[model samples]
Target: MADPAGLPPRLRPSTVPPPAAVTRALHAINTCTSAAALAPLRVHILREPALLRSTAVISAFFLACGRLRSLDPALVLFASLPRPHVFVFNSLLRSLPQAPACSPLPLLRHFLGLGARPNRYTFPLMLTSLSSLRELNVAHSQVAKSGFARDLHVRNALLARYAACDPDLGHAEQLFDEMPRPDVVSWTTVITAYRNHGHSFLALATFRRMFAASVAPNRVTMVSALGACAAHGAVDTGIWIHQYVQKLGWELDVVLGTALVDMYGKCGHVAEGVRVFSKMTERNVFTWNSIIGAFALVQDGEMALRWFFRMKADGIRPDAVTLICVLYACVHAGLVDIGRKIFNLIVQGEYGFQPGIKHFGCMVDLLSRSGHLNDAFRVVEAMPSQPNAVIWGLLLRGCKDHGDSVLSEHVTMQLLELEPENASHYVTLANLYAETGRWLEAHEVLKWMKEKGLAKDAGWSLRMLEDRSSKCISDGNFMECAL
Candidate 1:
């Protein structure tokens, strides 16, 4: 018997004509959390003459229930409404995007049929569900036809749609530069598209260009550039960016701070990573993961474990990423028992978190490093399903570690079947054969790899430069890259 519309007392519309019906419908829409409430609300509106005709009342109801449960009711209500206008169609189209289950194509068809020109809001929402470039190009054409091209918001959304669908960043750049004056979102979208396409240098250049144009970068711009710096191991540039962030008094932002830590960590500045991490006022799961990984990468597994325990004690739940980093720590520290314990925790602990391929790979590495080749094989054999290339690759590497020729051969065959083009598989198997002085067999394996046109990789060097003054150089052995 409570008023079905659950408007807060302060927000309740006082001057509205049908207060009780409005209040009840609003409550049903806003307060309704389940399908049962939605069913009754639908019946109530249909039965109530006053509520049936008010667009404001119906729109409020749909907005309150959100898109998932409101679609069918919206359609029913649209059919019954005496004058369903363009705004009504727009509302329905907007709702279609809220749920991944509902396809936007039907809504697009309906909108076109109504001859309703898609306003600025329409294409952006429609672009979200688009899966292919062809559909996106169609949407892009519609935007031009509607003359929203010069509208910055619509253009920015178009840039985003292109950035998302187009593998090449050319269209993104063109769209970005064509804007009369690109705003921060425009610049950020362009930079992000380049960064995502593995053009880190280009992303960094864009940021500089934005700055050179007297356009100030926002938090998103700085964060994205910092990510590119991190990936490329440009520590000096990263540090300069960090200083800029601090000077602007934005260093306290958790997102930006976390990126700084990750950048420093990946650049081989572990101490700097720890320093940035310590200064963070707010630590997220990613923050913990970065610091732990930094320690693990530096072979300071003890510190990684320390942080892992601290993370749990701090009441932040560990996710698969957290576990993966901790498992790597166990691998580095040669803590087979600890690795097994962590593996069991993931597989059967109170959280009952499912183990991913990386987790299983860590387990295999741990077991193999401990001279437990058969146990490593057992772990692979006991997997819930067939193993992936990583699992088989790890097992093969473990066999190499323990000089187990038979198991190595078996794993090599499996790896070849899983990833036939992987040159390293043949190389690993060849190395195992050579260990037993089976030179001919080893040479044959290498010959087969060459014959298959799988090119073996050579070692590479990474030189990160910061201006002409500061540089940090690091070289990685091929083992890590090969795996």
Candidate 2:
């Protein structure tokens, strides 16, 4: 016998020796990091039945490496095995459910092609891969037909899948109600489903049901509930969840701590949001984006900018989401110079980073708001491609503010032509014409609006009284021609 790692024997078996070649092949296969390295090893292994030391070990290795690449490699290895068993089949099938762009239907077809039947592990991943309600129904039918619908894990995964896709929450609630023996995971999944769909009340109701059933809320459950409370602006319930977290002494963990920061920030408690952020010993990009967005939303643009700079200083790279918030803050505070500088830095000065429509809109808004209508128009013209409706609309608004009748008229024609059904475009154009004392043009625009069977939506204005601090609402639906 040859040392598997050394050289092959002088007189090899005509049929090839099984254990030795397999051991050597497995060693070579294990060292492969990328798909390219696997090709030669795979070819060498497939040449001789001796390539696999044990069918079992080879199958396990295939599945283990499946995480790095996918089930395709495992499936290829399984094809060459002398005696492929259910374990190998199961490994490949299990890999399919989580595979990149992996389809449950295709995996099921492959299983059937292999003359193998799905066991308990099969349906859990299949149900998870069903990206939509239509796919869920197909998986649900397969589960029922396979007679594994009652299996706890399979059923729980199915419940989670339904919870994720059932936007109305009515179906998910009914399914949860019918489950005779729901576990903590099942309860949490359904509760989270409601939360994800923006049904905060139902999530709370689900929590109450869990407590009534004597089920203790775990970290996942509490975190989800806190998130729901924050999203729906349930400040009181959010506070209660915080107290519960403190009681359980789980606040130190970064994951839950970040969620708390996000929840408080969204609920308009900037102070609490900052406190939670300070408590987080480990902060990810998501945490930074959430807190920054919160400050922007609350009109604390300077605080938003401060945190943005601080985030970069702390060695955290600013992602597109961070830049979007920063640009928005600049727009809110009318910081045109700063906005222009940031825009130039990100879009032009940076090597790989590119600006999207959101960034362009910010620039247009910044230039337009500061009465630089021509500069704003020039920005749109200089865009690599044609401007979008949003881009053009920003210029039109700037035209309105600066009373740039020519620019307003030009943008109005372009906007209306682009988005004819948009009622605001017609109104904006008509307003521009009226502002310029072009009664004939204004009436013609209004006439076209009527001819197109589009009724102008009544416009309203909001004004705050300086002395009384009271808001006055004025109905400006009826157009007035001062000319």
Q: How many clashes show up in model 1?
A: 4
Q: Across residues 41-89, which tens digit of lDDT does each residue of candidate 2 receive?
A: 5566566655453554566456555645645666677665544565655
RMSD of each: 10.8, 9.1
233-350 in candidate 1: lDDT tens per residue?
A: 7777788888888898875668988888888888889898888888888989999898888888887888999999999899989888889889998998998887888898788864
Pairs in steric clash, model 2: 18-50, 22-50, 22-51, 22-52
Candidate number with greatest lDDT: 1
**For model 2, what is the C-alpha lDDT against the true structure?**
0.74
- Candidate 2 shows a clash count of 4
Which window of 10 residues has the lowest lDDT sum in candidate 1?
Answer: 461-470
Measured against the true structure, the TM-scores of the candidates, in listed sequence, are 0.80, 0.79
The collision pairs in model 1 are 5-23, 5-24, 5-27, 6-27
